[model samples]
Target: MIESPDGERTEHCGFIQKRGTNNIAELTAAIESLRRIPEGAEVILCSDSQYTLKGLGEWLPGWIRKGWKTASGSPVLNQEHWKLLHQEYLTRKVRLEWVRGHNGHPENETADQLANRGLTLG
Candidate 1:
């Protein structure tokens, strides 16, 4: 879900047919949100996944520098998605905000609900 600058909310939840992890879904959400907005638009991208947050804010640069390897020299998981998300993120002015999931954050709660609804889509 994305809340526009004018308080308009847009939902972009859907189920994936293939097996995937929660991190994949989270990354997809962030990636799709950035894809929807125009390049260079200022965006306040909120999420409840710390993996998504830290991976984007902290780990991404080092991972890229190390050819997508982690600190311990293991290959980074979800390389393709990270690459796409990183590319999308770089093309925009995005400020990532991490909201605690299931902590009474209305937007996060709504996203969770939407995600649950998406399960039926499969």
Candidate 2:
């Protein structure tokens, strides 16, 4: 995430996560981005995954109460990360923004790099 001056009291925060087919990894990155910010600060979350954006914001709570199962009774993938991210969201202040991927945004580029770095290390 990159924080730049946005007038006096607010800062412009930019976040990027690597492209992933797995919804969980991308959502995890989004949660991580939120966690990196200070509490009560306004944040702008930029992500390429609509699933991650909508799932966390819209689908999560129901999934949690449903024992991490999909509406059709299939076990949800990446339940642990989902739960962790849910907890993280409860503790931080943020806003979500969707950005087109691979458009050469700097923070997006950096986050892609960081995500790849984690992949390589594992």
How do all models score by TM-score? 0.96, 0.69
Off by over 4 Å in 1: none
- Model 2, residue pairs in steric clash: none
Give the range where candidate 2 is weakest over 10 consecutive residues by summed lDDT: 7-16
Whole-model Cα lDDT of every candidate shown, in order:
0.90, 0.68
Each prediction's Cα RMSD? 0.8, 5.5
Candidate 1 residue-wise lDDT, 4-114, digit = tens:
888988887888778989999988888888999999999888889999989999999999999999999999999999999999999999888889899999999999999
By TM-score, who's the top model here? 1
Residues 1-122 of candidate 2: C-alpha lDDT, one tens digit per residue: 55545633222222334444556568767666667677767766677788877777788878888989988989887777777777777776657777777789776776677666667643
- The window of 10 residues in a row where model 1 has the poorest summed lDDT is 9-18
The reply for model 2, stretches above 4 Å from the true place, is 4-24, 120-122
- How far off is residue 37 in model 2, in Å? 2.2
